[model samples]
Target: MHLLRRISTGGIALCAAAVTITACGSENSGGTTSHANGKVVLSIIVPTHTAPPTAPHAISAVRAAATAINAKGGINGKQIEIRTCNENGNPNDAVKCARQAVSDHSVAVVGSYSNSSNQLIAPLVKAGIPLVGFNAITPADYACAVCYTFDAGNTLSFAGMPAALRASGARTVTAVTLDLAAAAANVSAVEQAAKAAGLQTVPPVKVGVTSTDLAPAVQAVIGSKADAAVSVLPTEQTTAFIRAADQAKAPFTFGVVDAQVQSVLSQFRGTQGDHVLAVGAYPPLDATAAYPGLVQYKTELDAQEKTGDKDAATRDSISLRAWLSVHVVAQAAAGITGDITAASLNNGFRTAKDIDLYGIQPKWTPSAKGHVPGFDRVSNARVFFMRINNSKLVPAKPIAGLDLNTGKPF
Candidate 1:
C-alpha cells in the first residue's frame, strides 16, 4: 500500500482529512497591530459555521489561557492580545487570515485549526511569524520550518489505530470510512498498520455522504464478524452509526470513533459507546484532574463561563490543542530579554530546545531533528489511545502515549 511504502521511504499523508474542525473567518479583517503598554500580539485562525460547529471551543480555550496568564502577569509583563479570524474551510480565506496576521504584526499564530492549512503556511513563513500548535491537516504543516505542531495529527492517529485495537484483544478488525476517494488511502494505512500488529483486516465498509439510515452499515459490521470495528466517519455519521449499533446490540467492540463525537456520546452510558475507543491528539478530556495544567485550565474556563462565555468549558481535541498552543508561545516568550516581535518570537521558537506545556502535553523542541523524513515540523509525535468507561474517557493503554508514526507505546 502507498502508506506502507511511504513509511519505508518518508511519511504518509493518509487520514489528514478524516477529522473536521471549526475555524473563524470574515471577508476582510486584520489582527490588532497597535502594541501599546507592552502587549504581545497573537492570532488564531479557525473555521466557524462548518460541519460540527466546534471552532468556538478552540477560540474559548485560547481566550481562557490568555485570561489566566494575564491575571498573573502575562509573559514577563507583556500583556497577551489575541486576534481571531474565521478561515471557514476556504483556501482563499485561509490565505487572508495569514496575511492579516502578517499585516497586523502578530508575533505568532497559535492554536488554530482549518482543513485549508496548506494555504495558511506560506504567508506566515515569509513574514517570519511562527505558526504554533495548529491542527496538522496538510502536508505543508508537517514540512514547514516555522510550523510547530504540539500534538500528533490524524496521520499519526490512523497509523496507530490498528495497534490500539489489537491491544483490546481484537483478532480481526474491520474499517468503516466515508465513501470518498481520499478515504481510500486512510483505509490502506489502517490495513498496513493492522498487518504490522498481527491483526487481520477485513474489507472496509464505506458509507455515503448523504446516507440517512445507518442500519445497512451497522449490519455490514455485524456481518463481517470482525472482532472490532474502526470508524473513520464524521461526527454526525459516527453518532448515527453508534445509535444504530446500540439498537442492534452489535457484538464487536467499537475500536475507534471520532474524537469530535465524544461530547455528543458522553451522555450515552452503558451503550455501545461504553466500549468505544478513541485515538486523540491530546489526553482524553474527561481526565481533567490527571494533569495539573488541565486543572488550572478548567478553573480559568469556569471563570470565563461566569462572565457569559458559553463555550468556556468545552473540552475536545481542538480545544485542548488550542489551549496548549497559546501556552507554548507564552512559555517561549517568557525569557526573551528584549522586545518581543515576530522575528524574536520566531527565533525564540527555533532556538528554544524544550518548551514546557505544564504537563498537558510532552515537552516540545521545535529545533529537534525530524524522526520521519517528510515530517520535519512534527515537534511532538505522541498520541493517546483512550476508551470510554461509564461515559468518561480513560486511557486504553497503561502508558500515556504511543509513537505516532510507529504505533509503539512511549
Candidate 2:
C-alpha cells in the first residue's frame, strides 16, 4: 500500500484533506522567541474529539498529568504550559498539529491517538521541534529521517497477544486486522507466532479504520472455524467487531489487544460478551495503587476543571507515557545551558547516550542506527501481558519452564 502523506508543522494532510487540531494549548504561539523565565514551556497535543467521550477524557487525563508536573516545579524548575488541539483522531489533523507544534517553537510536544501520531514526523522535523509522544512506530518506520519520536517502550500489544493465545493452549487461530499500521503489525506478528507455535493459519481479513459496521468481519471470523480469534483494530471498532462476533457465536474464543480490551469490556460492561477475553500489554494502571504521580495529576485536573468532585483518574498508558515524554524533554534539556530550541533538543538526543525516564517508562536517545530513541533493552521492555479477568484485567504468566527467548510453552 502506498500513501503520499504531506507532513509539516501546519498539520498532517492525509490525501487531499487538510486537518488541524483545535488550538487549545496553554503556551505562546510563535516561530522563534527568547525566554527569560528560564522556564521551558511544553505544548501537549493530541486528537481530542476522535472517539466520542473517551478521547476527551483521555486528553484531559494527560493535561492533568502535565499540570501536576508543572505544580511540582516541572522539568528543570521550568513551569510547563500545555497547548492542546483536537486531532479529531484524523491523520491530517495530527500532521497539522505537529506542524503548528514544531513551527510555533514550543518546547516539544506530546500528541497521538494511534496512527494519528505517525502522521506528523515529517512536519515536526521541518518545524525543527522535538516531538516526544506515544506512537507504536513500526520497527522500520523508526528509520525515517523525519521521525525523532520518543517511544515509551512499554512493549507487548497485539505483539504479545498472540503469545497469550498460544499459552492458552489454542492450536489453531484466525485473526482480523483493521489493515492499519499497528493493527497490521499485530496481525502479522501474531501470525508469525502462531506458525512458530505450530498452529493452523486462516487467511487474513481486513477492515477500515473508520469502520463501525463489522457484521461482515464478524461473519468471516465465525465462519473461519479456528480455535482462536483475535482482532487488532481500534477500541471503538473492536467493540463493533466484538458485538458482531459475539452474536455470530463462533466456537473459538475471541481476544483483543491492549486498551481496546478495556474499551471492549467498558463498552459492553455488565453484558455477557459471549465469554470474550481481552488482552492488554501494560500492567493494569487501576489494578495497583495509582502511580504516585497520579494523585498530583488528579489534583491538577480538578484545579483545571474548577470542580471539586473529580472522580475519574488517569489509568491508561497513553497519558502516563505522555507525561513521561515531557519529562524526557526536561531531562534532556537540563543537559544544555543554551536556549531550548528544537535544534538543541535534537542535539541533546545526539549527545546524550541514554535518557532514563526514571522508570516512568524506559530511557531512549538517538542512535546512529535508529533515528528515534527510547529504551530498547530486552530487560527494559517492561510489558507484562495481562488479560481481562472477571470483567477486569489480570497479569498473564507464561507457561512454566517455557523458553523465555522463544516464548514457547514448556
Candidate 3:
C-alpha cells in the first residue's frame, strides 16, 4: 500500500526534487519573474540537535528551498539572504542567534525549537520579526501575528494529534516528552481532545533530552492505567525508551507527536514495530503519492544527474514544515516595491492570502485579526494529521476546515 509523507533533503536535494515547474513554480518556464526591488536579507535559524537527527535534513531543505526562490528571481529581484545560527541546544546560543538575526535588520527568522527557542526569539518576534517554526509549538499560545509560528504547516497539528488518537480507537493516552511549557501544552491539547472524544488522557511522563531510561516512564503510564503511551522525547532518547518498553513487555503502546519521529526514531516498524505511531502533516512525495508541482524540481535535477532527487521530497515533518516557511517568506518578499525590512515580511503574512505555493498544503491566507489578509479564522487553512506506519509517516486524516470561507470554527 502507498503511504503519503514528506522528507527533508540537503541543499542538493532541493534541486533534485525538480522535474519540471508547474503551479506557481511554473514561473521557471521563461525564468523567475523577478520583482524590481532592492535586495532583502533574512535569517533562518534551526536547532543544532533534536529527535530524528532532523536538523541537518531540515537545514538542507531550507537552503535548497532558498535556492529555488533565488532561481526564480527571488521576490521581485529582492534576493533573500539566509543566515544560519546553531543553537547547540543551548539557550544562550539561541538568545545570541536571536539577537544577531533581529539586530541585523533581517525581515524574518525561522527555526526555534522547544520553549527555549521560543523564549530566545520571543523578544525578536515582538520586535516585529515573523517566525516560522517546526518544533517550538506547545499547548500554550507561543507566537502571534507579528510572528506567525507555523508548526507542521499549522498550529492545528497539536489539536489534530489528539483527534487522531480518538480515531485510533484507543481508550487511554499516556504522553511523555521533554518537560517544559511546550510539553505541558502539547499534553494538554492531546489530553483535552482525547477526553472530549471519550478517551482518557492519562498523566504524562517527562524525559529529558539527555535521558536514556524508559523504565520509569513506562511504569508511570502503567500506573496511570493507560493502554497506550505517547512520548515527545528526542529521537535517541525515544529509541532507548522504546527498547526498554519492549523488553519490559509494557502493557501500553508508545508514540510521539513531533515530526522528528520519522528519521531515526521510527519506533513501530517491521515485526517489532507495532504499537508505535507518530502524527504526520503532508504526504511524503518521495515515497508514493501525487505531488504534482514537484515534477519540475525532479526533472530539473535529472538533467543535472543528481542521484538524490528523491531527497527533497522526503516525507518527514521538517520537510513540509520548513517548505511552508520558505514559501511564506518568499511570498512575503514578493511584494517589496523598493526597500526590505523585517516588518515588511511580518506584514506580508499579515495581509497575504490564498498563498498556495506549490499547493504545499492549502493557501494560508492571513487576515488582519491573525497572520495574513483575505483569510477567515477557519477558511484558508491547511491542517494535517498523520502517523507512523511500518516505521514511516502516512497521512491518515487532514482536518483542514478552511473551505467554509467563513473563518469561524464549526
lDDT for residue 266 in candidate 2, whole number 0-100: 56
How do the predictions measure up, each by TM-score?
A: 0.87, 0.70, 0.69
Q: Please give the ranking of all candidate structures by lDDT, highest first, separated by commas.
A: 1, 2, 3
lDDT of 2 at 51: 55
Model 1 RMSD in angstroms? 5.0
Candidate 3's C-alpha runs over 4 A off are 1-38, 49-54, 111-114, 133-136, 139-142, 149-155, 176-190, 201-225, 244-253, 265-269, 285-288, 291-315, 368-383, 397-410
Worst 10 residues of 2 by lDDT: 1-10
To one decimal, what is the Cα RMSD in angstroms of model 2 from the true structure? 8.9
lDDT of 3 by residue, 259-298 (tens): 5456653555553444555554455445333556445434
Candidate lDDT scores, in order, read 0.72, 0.52, 0.52
Q: CA lDDT of 297 in candidate 2?
A: 44
Please identify which of the two predictions, 1 or 3, would achieve the higher lDDT against the true structure: 1
Top candidate (lDDT): 1
| Model 2 error, position 235 (Å) | 3.2
